[model samples]
Target: MLGAQQPASDQDRRQYQRVKVMLHGRLMLSDRTEHRCQVVDMSPGSAFFATDATAKTGERVIAYIDHIGRLEGTVARVRDDGFALELNTTPRKKAKLAAQLTWLANKHELDLPEDRRHERILPRNPSGILSLEDGRQYRCRIIDLSVSGAAVEINVRPALGTQVTLGNMRGQVVRHFEDGIAIEFAVIQRRETLQQYLS
Candidate 1:
């Protein structure tokens, strides 16, 4: 489902290059309602998103994409399957977006894998308990598991680089997403036994 859209002129009749991506995220409307969506195509200044929620043209939207982080924009147009957003960002943010898009483009062109070092899997039993260094524990939902890292959905977000324990595995917070943080394990996990501790 990840494929580029044909180059089209924007509302201002300016054509911007776009790359195909299948990034999942939550879309927050002006009324604060959130819905799950997938970003189908993205450019530095705009993106095409597919979602079940409907919004009128010009409606404000705040999306927290997986790798790209938060993006604020206004609905520019609606398609049968989705809508387009005209992004509102500073010059610096735009530059970052450009770089991300380029990286995605090249990765796709070269057929590179996202995580080549480890094979990631969705745990059959996704529930786990996360404990902070202070001994506080919170229930967490495992998003995905890899030999080197795991993505978990938890309410408490510790500072970056904070050491934490998920079940019996120890790791440090390396990245944050809308739903949770990504932890890179202190030691590589044996793929055969990783799922036992995660559950």
Candidate 2:
């Protein structure tokens, strides 16, 4: 079951308010064991995650959340169904997390669709080279692109998480579709300059 949408307590609000969310990701334990988990709620300081993997309080955990990237923490508490983590990060990273949480909260409040983070458009040229980390390159067709990522049609499907270069852009293999794979850019691209590579 998902977390309830309840108002935050005064203390929670005063500290860092927790926002209800559903994000899928992998959790790595101190022993290097990995388990699939869903983040039920998150704040800048900590997050509540639901997973089948057993973990003790004070266990080190590293979660690689989609969109949010990696977050390291120690298990603060254990629940019947899941556990909570006390996040450990630098101030700059904490600020970034706060901003991301705010955006997610506002998007949910506005009932906005979550699938598209950036506006995707079909490139004018529709062609680019996909290069693997091992120095292999393949001719691929650009299906669509946005500032955040791109969908390309290629003959080969590299393993998920493989680092690759598409033209001049560096990104990782994020998803695989029947016809192609999706690449999420390491750094968000500038909308004004993105078309230059596409064209």
List TM-score per model, in order: 0.55, 0.56
Tens-digit lDDT track for model 2 on 1-199?
Answer: 2443222234543688889876667899999999978787999888998999899998989999866899888888899889998887666776788899998788557744333768888888888999997899999998988887889999999986677888888776767889999887766778876777556
- Against the true structure, candidate 2 has what lDDT? 0.80
Per-candidate Cα RMSD to the true structure, in Å, reads 12.5, 8.6
lDDT by candidate, in order shown: 0.79, 0.80
Give the worst 10-residue stretch by lDDT in candidate 2: 1-10
Scored by lDDT, model 1 comes in at 0.79
Model 1: per-residue lDDT, tens digit, 72-92? Answer: 888999988889998876667
TM-score winner: 2
After TM-score superposition, the amount by which residue 32's alpha carbon in candidate 2 deviates from its true location, in angstroms, is: 1.2
Model 2 misses residue 43 by how many Å? 0.6
